[model samples]
Each structure stands twice: as C-alpha cells, then as structure tokens.
Target: MNPLRILLLCHSFNSLSQRLFAELRAHGHTLSVELDIADSVTEEAVALFRPDLVLAPFLKRRIPPTVWQRVTCLVVHPGPPGDQGPSALDWAVWRGEPHWGVTVLQANGDFDAGPVWAHASFDMRPATKGSLYRREVTQAAWRATLAAVQRFAGGERSAPALPDDAPLVRWQPLLRQSERAIHWATESTTSVLAKLRSGDGQPGVLDTLWGQACYLGDAHPASAAAMAEFSDAEPGAMLAVREGALLRCTVDGGVWIGQARRADPPDTHPTQRSFKQVAAELFATEAAGLPQRPVPLQRSPDEWGELRYTEHGPEGARVGCLGFDFYNGAMSTARCERLRAALLQVRERPTKVLLLLGGEGFFSNGIDLNSIEAAAHRPGDSAADASWRNIQAMNDVALAVLQTTDRLTVSVLRGNAGAGGAFLALAADQVWAHGSVVLNPHYKNMGNLYGSEYWTYLLPRRLGDAGAKALMTQRLPLLAAEALKIGLLDHNDEGSRQGFEERSLERALALASSYNQSGELAAKQARREQDEAHRPLALYREQELARMHRNFYGFDPSYHVARHHFVHKQPHAWTPRHLAVHRP
Candidate 1:
C-alpha cells in the first residue's frame, strides 16, 4: 500500500500522541501536527495540512463536520464501537470492565459516531487510569492508526455502518468530591479497593484524617485483602504493616501514603510508625465522630430503576440484564424494595425460566454492614431492631425468589458469591456456576451473624441441617466444584455453562415457538412445591440465625488486638486472624 499524507490533531504533545506521530512518519507517510484545535485555529490548521486524512489521537476539541467532510478526519476512540465519548478509559476502569480497545473511525459531528476503519483490542489488567493508558491504549491506538491508513491507501476502506441495535455506550461523568466521600459505615472492602485502584496515582482515594482531606494511593487486591481481614480494628485504625509497602488499616487499608500534609503535623514517630499505632490514632479520630445523641436515619431518594421488558413470544419473555452488579452498598432496604418491584414486573410475564444473565463476577455482595452499624450508633434509635429489620428485608427478597410462580428462577453465577451474596444466588430454583466461581458465607469472619435472614431458610433446605451448621461454624469458602458436590450449585461445567443462561434462553424461545399450550401451570406447580418444601426450614432458620447474630455482636470485642500489635513494636507476622481470636 502506498503511503498517504496524514495530519495529526492532538490536544497536547503528550507521550501518546508523540509516539503516534513518530510511527506515522516512520511508515513513510507525510505528517503535520496540530497541537490545538480551538475554533479559530482548527480551520486554518486543516487548510494548511491539506492532507488526504486527519487523525485525532487525543484531541480534546470536537472536529467540525466541514473539516471532517473535506478531509477524511478519523477519531481513535479508546473503547468499544458504541462506547465513544470523553473519559472512556476512566469509565472503563471504574466499571471494572475486563476488555478495552481503540476504535479508529471517521470523525463525524456527532461525538464518537463515525464509520468504522480498524480497531486494536486488549485485555484490561489491574492497572490505574494513567498506567492503563500508557501500557495498553497508547500502543493499541498507534496500531489502529497504521491499520486505518493501510486500508484507506489500498482502496479497501469499507464503511461498516454502526448497528442500530447496539447498546448505547454508557458514559461515566468525572468523579465529584461528594462521590469520593469515604463512608466507612457503608462501603465494603472489595468496593473500597476498586475505588482506590480506579483513582490510583491520580487525585487519589478520598479519605479524611482529623477532618482534613487526605489522598490514599493505589493498593492492589492482595494488600486490600490483608487490610480488610484486620477491619476488627477501630474504624480508620492501622492494624498491620508490610515492610516498605503499606500500613494496613480498618476503613482504607493497604493505602500507600503518597503525600501527607496538615495545618499541624500528624503526631507520630515522625518517620514510619508501626501499623498498630496508626490504627489506634485513626480509630480515636473516627470514634470522636460518633454522636452522643441518636442520629436519625436520613432517608434519601430511591435511585433504583428497572429495565423495561417486552414479551418475545406467547410462552417466552426477554429482559436485558444491562450488566447490573450489586456492590457492597447496593443492598439497602430501599434498593431491595426497588428490586422486589422490578422482579414482580418481570415475573408477570408468561415465561418458563427467569434467567439472570449479566453481572459477571458479581451476583450481590449482600446487605451493607456499614449502614447497619451506623444506624445502630444513632441516638434514640434502636440499632438492634433496625439491624434485624434490614436483615429481614434482605431475607424477604430471597424468599420471594423461592415463591415466584410461572417461572423457574435460575441464577447463573459467573463470579464470587459470599454471605448474603451467596444466599441470593442459592435462593434460585437452580444455580449454574462458572468453573472458577467461589461461594462462601463470610459473615462469621466479619463478626456478624452466620447468614442473613434467608440463610435460615435457604441453607438447611439446600444443605441438610448438619451441613448448614458445619458451613456456618467453619466459615469455609466453597469453590465452584465443591459447591456443586454439596448441591449448592446444580451445574458446574466450565465450557457448557460458559454462557448457559443466554444460550438456554435462545433454546427456550425455540421451544416456546412450538408450545401447543401455555407451560404456566407446570411452572406454577414447580414453584409451589419449592415454597412448601422450604417454608418450614426457612422459619426455623430465621430464628436461629437472629439468635446467632445477637450473640455474636453482644460479645463484640471492643479493642482490636491487631491494633495492639501496631501500638506495640510487634513484628508483622501477627496476622489479623491471630488478633481477632484474642480480641478483648
């Protein structure tokens, strides 16, 4: 293919754009650089370049339609075809997408909507926003530019029109200060870790020390795991230390202290202190925020919405999963109520099987423990009663799954399920887990009840009474294979269950097409049997589970021994578990 003259429009002479310019020049193409595309200079720059094609690698300003029409202006979007917009990289990182790439296409007046040219894709790794761009995206963009150029020059530029059926690429707005508030009482360790990773090496994770804003640097999952395990320490307490690595704490553990500044210097050893000392100080500060008076639960507007489903056939129904993942704070009573409403709306359809297909790697992370703790601390509030009610609300949703008629609810577990999270998956008539998935009731580890309200009912029903007791007491995690053996999961074939529900949905529709009569009666009968079989066990379990939780929290250890480790000059060998067992 013969080389074509190219004009590169970029926001800055940054490393990414600079590299692209070098590659285009090395490919023997005539290249001109336009560093800025302000309204005044854009036209003049385009006219001056007078090249066959204009490529914008990281240009901030939108290219005018006239300029794009005159020259074959192409925009290299760092996302999937439909996902074209500003800050695609940031959004992808925030959403924890596993795949990301660059799409080089015609730059039309409409933001990222343009005819296809070529794309280079890559898998998303555990990387920060800046690191991800530097490693995967920058190189992919360069490759895409060359490919597009080659196709255009070889007279093989075929316009693949954007599909109308493609899902609109969801855009995430820039993170706001309010959104960054570290609500220790509301967020889970996993979610907090993701937030830290998303903001790694940038603005940094928002944290407060002595009411002053502090930025915590990027922490890996393993490091966060260490910190979460020691969460028995007081909120904001540093419990452990990894040498020259991180100070593990309660709320935001595994945080690398990138930069610390205050009106007053933090009282410490001046240099690096042990994890216990850090935890003690931080805990004291957090404890001071607790109200002497009861704090009322401030109700917020219900921010939950459901997908509008449409009937596919006489005996078939289709609802888009839309990739809903219930994170740590997602299981509030308000959200549960909204989910109940949504489930009811979909359950009305004359469908045989209700398949939850999306939310890969997460089913639900269970009720927000932080929220329960917060409500419990409020003055004039019956924290104990509130906690019980919240658990009941969660259990209700699980029980509803068992009682739903006219459809066999099948949970396709594509990732980790734990605590109420695991029970949510178990509530379904049948659970199909991907090979690498894990199921565990982790409440015991967190010093909470064995399982929430549904555990009483669902656990013994699936696993015999003896099995449920063993699981609850041991707090052992079950891998997918083991979970299948224990009857927790019905099917666990890695390949066959890869996209079981989706593939089965297609097959169901085909069968529905040939149905001489409604299969609604059969579905209802099946649901009735399940409800009857489980109702007695669920009631008994609910009582026992509540008793377990009350007992657990009543004897809650106040001062964390791990925090003691950091307080005293103890070796890092004292794991969080050691301290937790000896808690006073």
Candidate 2:
C-alpha cells in the first residue's frame, strides 16, 4: 500500500493519545499530531497535513465542522456504538453490561454523533473504570484505527452512514460526592453491593459516618443468618475477635462480621464487644422477650418464644423495639440455637407486620465464631461435620427468614452492618438505617467461606448474575444512599430511633395492610420462574463444581494457602483484588 498522509488530533497529549500517535507514525505513514481540538488549531493542522485521514483517538473536546469537512476526520469513541460520550466506562461497569467496544466514526459537528466507520467489541470483565479505558478501549482503538487507515488508503471505506432518526447522544455526568452518599434504611445489600463494586479499589463508596467523610472498601454480600451466626455484638459495636475475625452490624438487625486489621492497635477497653458478641446478646434478648408458645422442632414440640408484639388497630401489630448493647454478649452455640428458634417463632406469628428496631446504638451483630471454633476443637468425634452442620443450620435459618410470608418484617438499623448482619437486613421485606450506619460484608477477610444461603438467590434477583458475582466474590460494601439508588432498601430516612421507627413502621404497615397475603405466593412464583430460567445454567454449575472438586479436593494447597494468608494477614496488607480471590 502507498504511504498515506494522516493528521492525528487529540484533546491533550495524554498517555493514551501519545501511544496512538507513536503507533501511527511507526506504520510508515506521514503523520502529524495536534494536541488541541480548538477550531483554529484543528483547521490549521488539517490544512497543513492535507492528509488522507484525520484521526482522533482521545479527543475530549468537540472538533469544528471546518476541520472535519476539510479532511476525512474519524473519531474513536471508547464504548459501544450506542453508548457514547464521557463516563462511558463508568456507566458500563455500573450497569454490568456484557460487552464493550470501540467505535470509529466519521467526525461531525455534533459530538459523538458521527457515522460509524468500523467497530470492535469485547467482553467486559469486572474491571474498574480506569482499567477498562486504559486496557480494553485503548488497545481496541489502536487496532481499529490502524485497520481504518489501511482501508481508507485502499479506498475501501465502508463507513455506515448516520441515520437521521438515530437515537440522540447520551452522556453521564461525573459522579458527585453527594450523589455517592449511603442511604441505609432503604438500601438493599444488592444495591449497596453494586455501588461498592463500582467504586472498588478507588476512593471507594463515599459516606459520612457521624458527619466524618469515610471512604469504604472491601465489601461483600452475605446472609443475615450467616452474619448472625458469625457475630456476637450489637450492629454498630465492635465485638470480640474469634481467631482473627471481627464482627459488626447492618442497618437491619443482622450481623456484619469479618476479620480485624492486625496492624491497627487493639482497643484496650475490656467492655468492647465484637459484632458477633453483640449480635448474640441482642438475639438472646429479642428471643427472651417473645411470648412463650409450643413450636415443633425436628420431631418434637418445644415451647418456643415470640417477640413482643403490640396491636396498632386495623393497621396491624407492631413488634416492640429490641434493645441491643454494642458492648456485651455471650458467644455460644446454645445462644445461636436460641436466637434462631426465637426468630423462627417470630416468623411463625400470624401478624402481618413485624418491626425489629435495634437499640439506640446498635443491631444484632451476627453469630460467634469463637464459640464455633471452641466447639469444633472440643474432643468431639465429628468436629468438621459438626462445624459444617452449624453453618448449614445458619443457612437454613436465613433462608427461612427470606422465605417468610406471614409477616412483613422490617429491620430498622442505626449503626454499622457487617457480614451476615447485612444479609439479615436482606432477608427482611423492608430495611431502614440511620445516616450514621455503615454496612460491610467483609467475609473474605475472615477465614471461613461465605456460608449464607440467601446471597445465592437474593443477590442475583436484585442485581443480576454478573453484579451478584462481582459483589460477593469481590467483597465490597455500600453506603446507605447509594444502596437506595440501587434498590437494596425499601425506604430511608435520617433521624433518631423513634423517628426512624415511626417512619419505618408506617411504611411497613402500609405495605402489609394494603397488599393481600399474596407475597408468599408471588415469591414462590418468582422463584419458580427463576428456577426455570436458570435450570440449565444451574446444572452446568453443579457439573463444573463436581469436576473441580474431583480434580482439586484433596490436593488443593491453594485453598489452604489462601485461608492462611487471609486469616493471618492484616487488613491493610492486601488490596481488594487479593481479598476477592479468597472469598467463598
């Protein structure tokens, strides 16, 4: 092919544009680079080059019509053909789009409203905005531009003409701090999870805890029952450490428990309880407050207790606020069993609504892993199986809560929600959290697998499969407000316990009273539909798992190594990527 003259126009001489310029020049073409897209500069550059093709690889500003008309100017947009403009990668990642592409189009007066010349598409991975643009789009642009130049030189320009009725150009504005605020009450674990993953390894999901700007990272979605089983403190309180894990609370009365940083100095206050400890205490207290009733266990009837409920007239009954102390709780299997039994009793109630308002400063922090370890280490005959059974029991309990239909449960949270605590909130029909609350699912940081069953179904239902995988596998967290935007919570309001309780109860009652008791039926129908849709995929997954286990079960040193690394290492020692690899 004959050497062709090319004019390379860029908004700035940034790294990306510079690389493109180098590539073009290396191709033995007569190339001139213009660092500005200003009308006069672009016109002058186009005139001087008199090139066969004018290419723009990374120009942010608009190019004048004079310059485009003067030469065969082509713009390379870093997104799919339809998804043009700034923040393209951000939107793509946020939406969890399957594919991303680079679009080479004829430059026109209107920005990104050009006729398509050539396009290259690729699958989008769980990538950050910077990574997607830097790696995928940048490379695609390089390859596409080179090919386009060759085609133009050969007079094979098969550029598709822009239709008059094409969709209007769309743009996403830069993310603002205010827009990133976490709204606890109405935000769901899935919604918050997406936001956290969207902001992974960056400044992270933004939030103001007690009016202090806090950048959150390393979050994931877990089951409320799992969180409850793992934590032993009030929702916001720092409970005791089991092995190396630390537990906290979610907006709802669930547990948020995970590993604590070894680098950070330990709190000297003996009164401090880890999230698991506090959650166990709250669970016990709530269970004890319940009205005694005969409930059937596996094969026998046991006198189970129900949470305190008060009638609200035709509106429905309101469960009394469950008090929780962020600082005190006993961690034991018996406690977990009791808490589970109590919650089950509450679920069995014939009432239409149940509002679980945690104490002034906290909610349930989840279960006690220390107690779990202690039980496992006991000279028992089957410690491993027993431990696994405990986890299964927790999963079953969480699933029960998720499947509950008789009561429209509302978890009104006021503090930190971590791990299973966050999942507990997920099980509820509605969840509310104060602005001061912080929600985290730090499961990977803990040594155990993310055993919560609710996540398997709830996450995919709320945020799609890709989003759910990213959130759970990546271990990210979401602030309250961001949670709201993503549809995690039903309603959110910033205020005191009484104020939040009043609002949450009103909303829950409205929902419970208005709709006929068809939620359970509807849920079953939805489950059936999803099951039908995913049957093939589920079978494939099961097959894959079986094959993986067969291949690596006994000899998988990687699993042990990962467990050791996570259990022994400090929180700040690893990045988000490292933590995600080990998350169950």
Candidate 3:
C-alpha cells in the first residue's frame, strides 16, 4: 500500500499522541501535528497540510465540521462501540469493570456516534485512571488505531456494520465529584481507593486536608503494620507521615495520600492552582505534628515505600534487587539523594549481580518540574537553584551507579523512560526493557535542555559519537525493539509487568550463577579503567555540568518558561516544528 499523508490533531502531545507519532512514522506515514487550539487553527492546518486523513489520537473537543466534511477524520475513543462521552475510562475504573475497550470511529455530526472503523478490548486492572490509560488503554488504542489506518490506506472509506452486541454498551455521563465522594464513616479502604484513583492525574477527588479544601491523589494502601498502630485513631484522623505521603486512617485501615492540590488558593500563585505537590509539602505544618513512620530498606513485599531492597540466591551466587518506585517517576533532589544512598547501600552487599528495577508506570522522567516550579513561590528558593540542586543530585545517583565495578548491574525498565532517566539507565553495565516500553532518550524537547546525567560520555560510548549526535537531534520516542536494534537496549523481553519481573529475575539469576561471571566482571572493570585512563570521568562530569549550569542559571529563560507552562498544564499555542512536519 502507498503511504498516506496524515495530520494528527490533539489537545496536547501526551503519551498516547507521542506513541502514535513514533509508531505511525515508523510505518512510513508522513505525519504532522496540529494542537486543537481553535476550530480556525485546525481548519487552517488541514488546508495547509492537505493530509489525506486527520487522526485524533487524544482530543477533548469535537472536530470542526468544516474540516471533517472536507476530509476524512478518525477519532480514537477510549471506549467500546456504542459507548460515548468524555470520562469513559473514569467511569469504567470507578465501577471496577473487569473489561474495557478502545474504538476508532469516523467523525460525524453527533459525538461518538460515527462509523466504527475498528475496536479492541482488554481486561482491566486495579489501578489509577492515569495508570490504566498509560498501559492497557494505550496498547489497545494503538492496535485499533493502526487497524483503522490500515483500512483507510487500503481505500476502505465505509465502516463495517456494528456487531450484534453493540447495543449492550451504553453511553456514560461525566463522572462528577459528588458521585465519587468518600463516606469516611462507612467506606472501606477498597471503595475509598476507587474514588481516589478514578479521577487521579486530572481533577482529583474533591476533599479536604485539615479542613482546607483541596484535591487528593497519588494514594497507596497502608501496610498492615502501619495500620496496626493506628487502630484506635478515628477513620478520618491523620496517622503518620512517610516519604512525603500522609497516612490517613480509613474505617477498616489506613491509606497513604501521596499528593494534593489546593482547590482555593489566594489566586496569587498559579502553581498552587495548577499542579499537585507532595502531600507532606502541601500540609507541612500539620504533617510536622504527625508521627514519623520509617520502614527498613528491606521491608516486606506487602509494605509500601518508594525504595526497597531484596536479595535472593545463595551467598556466593546472590543477586540483589534495588527498586525505587517514585510517584509518577519524577525524581526531585531529595529523591535522587535517597536513591543515591540506597544504591551505595546495595553495593556493599555480597552479590554477583544487581538489578535496578525502576517504578511501574515510569522509570523516571528526570527532575521534578512541579517541585521546581513550586520553588519559585518560596521565599529564598528559585527554580534555577532547585534545577541545579536536582541535577547535581541526579548526577550523584548516576555516579554511584557508574562507580560500582565490583558486581554486574542491569537497569530493568518495566515502563516508559525519558530525558536524563534514559541516560541514567546507561550507567548500568546492561540495559533491558519490556517490549511495551517507550524511551525518549533526548532532552531537547524539554526546552532544549542540555541534559547532564553524564549522557555526553554515556551515549557516545553506546552509539558512538556520530550516532549519539543523530539520536539527540532526532528528539523522538524509541520503542523497545527499535532501541535494542539501535544498540540502546541490550535485551527486550515481551510480557505483562508480572511476567517481565519473573523473566528478569530469571535472567539475573543466570548471570549471577554463570561460570564466567567473574571473568565478565573483571572485563567490565578493565574496560572502565581503560576508559578512565583515556579521559577521566571527572572531566566528563565537569564538561556536562558546565553546560547544565548554564541551562539552569543562564541568561536564556527558555527552560524555566517551558517548565512553568508544562507544570501548570498550559495549553499549547502551536505545535513544535519537529512534530509539525508540514511546516517549512
């Protein structure tokens, strides 16, 4: 089939849009993106690009009839056929539906009532609406959208008739906060969790923190041990604080609230109104009064914490697992320092191989933009200072990983990774990822950031100087298979998260027990020594930090401006030229 020119219309270039952009382009499609700023803007885009079809991967608004009538428009809905309206995933998650789907429909006069080009379904899991969308919803949407695009490329203009069971699915209205209210007196942990997660990463559950109106999110179930001491506390009482999350007692047990946003700020600071901050920071005074509950680094599996260490296999052939599950995978300066300490601690263990298992939804997206933006409002702190500190702390973490020469180390990515996090993974002896993973290895997208996780040295070593330069300039996402083919990843395992974990452990065990394990370790140390002799690691650090320091404190305010708009969720005025292929 001949390749077609496609225009992507989206509210923002979110995860789904980015994934689609990468995959469709890989399939030989000439694509351009136009942000859904206004009907006039979209129409102008269609007129200028004159694409054969317009694909709306993620949009919150209806397509302009003028454009749709002029050309074919495909809208990807996060719902099954016959299901309509916004908040489809919200209602599904809140209701605990066992199965859900994605439908690709042709645009028409009515919303979500268009011809069904394609549809796909998957079993749902207990997770936040954002998490579900990022994983299952994204995978299903990709498949269905690709199928629809294929059909269109084959000259199929008309959609097939709806299935016999299409009538079974019904439209669901927007999920309101009142319907998601938590009855602290009667609701169990499970129900409360459902309500909190349903609207997570968006309009969170409308609630209060110490009688202050706010939105609550990033919740985790409190461990049994944490709840045992709080049994006498009232259902709504604040129990303890750990790792920037507040433990609030539920009727049956307790739940950890990780983040919150003030519903009614003084209108003085937009950060308060725009982004969610770590709950402990939001309620610092109140949280200070609560008891501190610290758990061991090697806690039980059922326990909840950002950092955890576990060991397996016999003493001589032991394999250590160092896991850091930061919320949403944004590593603030504090988090990076904590992870650095944890890495150093794990290195002391008598293990032959170590696995760096990052968080579930994201390995890391680099420094926390929200926190840096929030710093602008503080009295003595500035975003530049925070950026500098955070990047330095991240460098510390990377240095710790790079300096560990006694044992073999592998960076295992079970989810998406971007920016410095992608390079940080390169600090390991080997990098492995699940097939579903997407990696945005370059940092230029974040306001042309000159990234500083020693990427200057790390990337060139992996891809050579010319290849590294090409990749950095590309500014695109890389799928796991493509990454491996390009030598960015050493292994690409295909499976669910659970299956990936099991398979990775098996591989790590094999490496730990291999007869040539000692030889491999010695070879790795020798190579590191050779590289250091050619150019000291400190020299690389100095050069990278020099550029990064300018990014943080330099005269150009692009980085700060971009970060502010990003953390505040500002609408895009126009699409980036790199993504707007039709431009120029």
Candidate 4:
C-alpha cells in the first residue's frame, strides 16, 4: 500500500497516540497531530493539513460531520464490534469479561456505530483498567488500526455491512462513580479488587477512609498468609500499612489500597482538591496510627512491592536482577532514594552482571510531578523544595548506576521511557529494549525542563555533541528500532512482552558468562577513568543542576504551571505547536 497523509486526532497525545504515531511514521506515512480541542479548530486543521485520513486513536468527543464527510476518518474505539461506549474498558473490567478488543470503524453520526473496518481481540487479564488499556488495548488497537488504514490506502472506501444479529442500539453509558463505589463490609476481596481495578487511574472508587471522603485505587490482594493473620479482624477494618499502602480486611480476605485522592467538597478550590497520591501519604495521620509491616527486598512472587531483587545463576557467574515497578514509573524523592539503596545493595551481591528491569508499561518518567504538586499543600514543604529534592534523588540513582563499573550493568527497557528516564538508561554499559518500546529522550515537553539525570554527561558520550543537542530539541517519540539505528539503544529485540523478558534474561546470562567478561570490565573501568580525568562527572552534574535550579526556582512558572495542569488532569486548551503541524 502506498503511504498516505494521516492526521492523528486525540484528546491528548497519550501512550496509545504516541505508539500509533511512532508505528505509523515507521510505516512511511506522512503524519501530523491535532488535539481534539474544538470542532472549529479541527475543521481548520483539516483544511490546512488536507490529510487523506484522520485517525482518532483516543478522543472523548465525536468528530464533526463537516470534517468526516469531507475526508475519511477512522475512529479507534477501545471495544469489540457492537460495543459502543465511553467507558468500555471500565465496564469490561468491572464485569470481569473474559475477552475484550479494539475496533477500527468509519466515523458516522452515532458514536461507535460506524461501519467496522477492522477488529482485534485479546483474552482479558486480571489487572487494572489502565494496565489493560496500556498493554492489550494498545496492541490490539495498533493491529486493527493498521489493517483499517491499509484497507483505506488500498482504495477500499466501502465497509461491509454489520451482521443482522448485531444490536441496532448497543450503547453502554459511561460508568459512574456510584457504580464503582466499594462495599467494604459486604464485598469479598475479589469483589473489592474488581471495583478498584475498574476505576484505577481515573475516577477511582469513591469511598470514605477514616471518615474522610476519598477516591480509592491501585489495589493489590494481600498475601494468603497476611490475610490469614488478619482473618479475625472486622471487615472494612484498616489492618496495617505496608510500603505506603493501607491494608484493609474484607469479608473473605484483605487488599492493599496503594493510592487515593481526596474527594474535597464542591466549595473547595479545584487546586486544593487533591490529586492522587500514596494512600499512606494522603492519610498520613491515620496511617501513622496503624502498625507498619515491611517486607524483605526479596520475597515470594505473591507479595506486592515497588522494588524486588533476585539472583540468577551460580556463585561466580551469578546475575542480579533488580526490578523497580513504581506506579506509572513516577519516582518521587522517596522512591528514588529507595531505588538508589536497592541499587547499592544489589551491587554488593557476588554477581558479574546486574539487570535493571524497570516496571511494567513504563521504565521511568523522571521526577514525580504529582508528588511535588501535593507537597505544596503540606505544612512545611514547598513544591520548589520538593522538586529540587526529587531531582537530586533521581540524580543520585543515575550516579549509582554510572558508578557500578565492576559489574556489567544493563538497563532493560521492558516498557516505555521518557525524559530523564531515557538518559538514566544510558548510564548503564548497554541499554536494551523490545521493538514495541517508545522513548521520549527530551524533557522540554514538561515545561522546557532542562533535565538533570547526568544527561549532559551520559547523552553526549552516546550520541556525540551535535547528535545529543539535536535529540534534546526534537521533542518526538523514538521507536526502539530507530533508537538502535542511532546510538540511543545498544540492542533491540522483536518479541512479545513475555518473550522479551525471557530473551533479555538469556542475553544477560550470556553477557555474564562471556569469555571476555573480565576484559570488558577492565575496558569499561579504563574508559570511565579517562572520561573522569577529561571532565569530572561532578562538573557535568553541577552544570546541569544550575539550569535545573532555574526550572525549579527561577522566575518562569512554566514548570509549575505545567505540573499543576498535568497532575490535575486539566483538559487541553490548545494543541502544542510541535504536535499540530498545521498550526503556525
């Protein structure tokens, strides 16, 4: 099929949109992005870009008839054929549907009732709505969208009619907070989990904790042993606090509620209405009264945690795998400190190689903006101070990675990475990622943040001066294959997420047992010494932090303003010029 001009219309350039953009561009399509700001603005974009097709990967509003009638428009609905709704995933998850899918259909007067162009389905997994959408929904949507786009590119304008058995009007209304409310006293652990998972990451299950109204989410089932210990506790009773989560007993078992947002009164200012934060932090006073239950850094698979360490292979050739699965890959000051401590501890192990497998769905996304925003409300803390502390903690983690010269350190990106996280990967001797991983290596999008994860020292060495400068300004997502073609990635493998994990482990073991492992380590040490002599790492850090200090404490409020909007989930007023190519 000949490549065609495509305009991506989305509510926000979310993960799905970024993946579509990267994949479509890789297929040689001329693409532009226009946020679904307003009907008139979208019409103007259609006039300017004159795209052959408009692909709506993620949108809350329907496309205007004036634009869809003039050009072929494909709406990527996150549902199977005949499923029409704004909250398809939420409903599917809440009901524990065995299967779900993505459908590519032509834009029509009725929402999600258009002629089906393509559809792809996947067996449902027990996970949060956000997790399902990021993984299964994204992959299925890409496949279906690609097929639909190909059909259009091949001059197939007409879509086949829907089956006669199809419902004439199967519209599932948006799932409301009332539907997601949890009944702690009556519901079992599994039931409570379903309610929380369905609303995880947005409009979390509205509930009262410690007599204060709040939205609950990021729940995990307590271990069987832990639940057994709390079996006698009254249902709905807060049992304990562990790793920043609150464990509450259920009728059958117990669950750890990891995150929450305060449901402030309507009279409260929007800015003061809390965004999601660690549940323990959100209700710090109450959590303090509960007993603290800390788990070992290495534990059973049934246990839940943000960080875990495991050793592979025998004695001398052993490989250490440290996985840090932070929620949404947001590293607050505390998380960074925890990660740094884990890195240091893992280094002490008698292992020749260390694998840093960062989270599912995201490797890391730099400093936690939400945490910093919440800091503003704390009694003695300010956002600026919190930002400084978080960045420094992040820098400390990167530095620890850089200093691990004795072992062969590998940063395996099992998921997407952006901003300082991208550079943090470079701190390792080699960076590996699967083909599906997307990397946003620049931090300008977060209010022109001059990032400080030793990127000045790490990036320039990887891509040289000019290439590094160019990448810092590109402000675009780079696919793993393209990253390998350039110097951004050392290795890229094509495989499913599970396959990638297996292969990455195999590769890491191979590196650990390499014939010239000692020689490679020596060479690495020598180069580090030479680089240190040429320009101290501290100098690079100092220079980077100088610029970052301005971003955090300087006159320009762009970083703070952007952070507030992002944490608050504010709707976009206009598309960024970099994304909306039709704009001046």
Which digits, one per residue and each the tens of the lDDT, describe model 3 over residues 151-216?
Answer: 999999888888676766577888998998888878899999999999899899988889988889
Error of 4 at 266 (Å): 3.1
Task: List the candidates ranked by lDDT, beginning with the highest.
Answer: 4, 3, 1, 2
Model 4 has how many clashing residue pairs?
0
What digit string (tens of lDDT, one per residue) describes model 4 on residues 124-227? 99999998888889889999999998888999997757678754556999999888877877998889999999999988999989999899999999988777
TM for every model, in the order presented, reads: 0.46, 0.40, 0.97, 0.98
User: Candidate 2 has what TM-score?
Assistant: 0.40
User: Worst ten-residue run, lDDT, model 4?
Assistant: 160-169
- How well is each residue in 1-584 modelled by candidate 2, as lDDT tens digits? 66787766765443356456555655677666666635675676566557788788876677777877767888888776765666566567667788878888888776676778777777786644544554466667776777677778778655756567744566667655455555665665455545555554343555533233345433434445434543554434333322122233445532232211111125633222221222223233333432322222222111111123333426353442332222112213444455466566655555666665543333544544434433433465332343444444545545556556555667777554555556656766667776434455435534434435355555566668886667667444455555666666666575532366567667766666665646654775576567658653345334533433332233544433443342232123222333122112
Q: Pick the candidate with the highest lDDT.
A: 4
Per-residue CA lDDT of model 1 for 152-250, tens digit only, reads 888775655556785566555566546655566556555655666666544556676556555654343334333445556665544432211234343
Clash totals for all candidate models: 11, 66, 0, 0
Q: How many angstroms is residue 92 displaced in model 4 relative to the true structure, after the best TM-score fit? A: 1.3
Model 3 clash pairs are: none
RMSD (Cα, Å) for all candidates, in order, is 20.0, 19.1, 1.6, 1.5
Error of 4 at 236 (Å): 0.9
**Candidate 2 Cα errors over 4 Å, as ranges:** 1-332, 356-367, 381-386, 448-450, 496-498, 515-584
Query: Which order, best to worst by TM-score?
Result: 4, 3, 1, 2
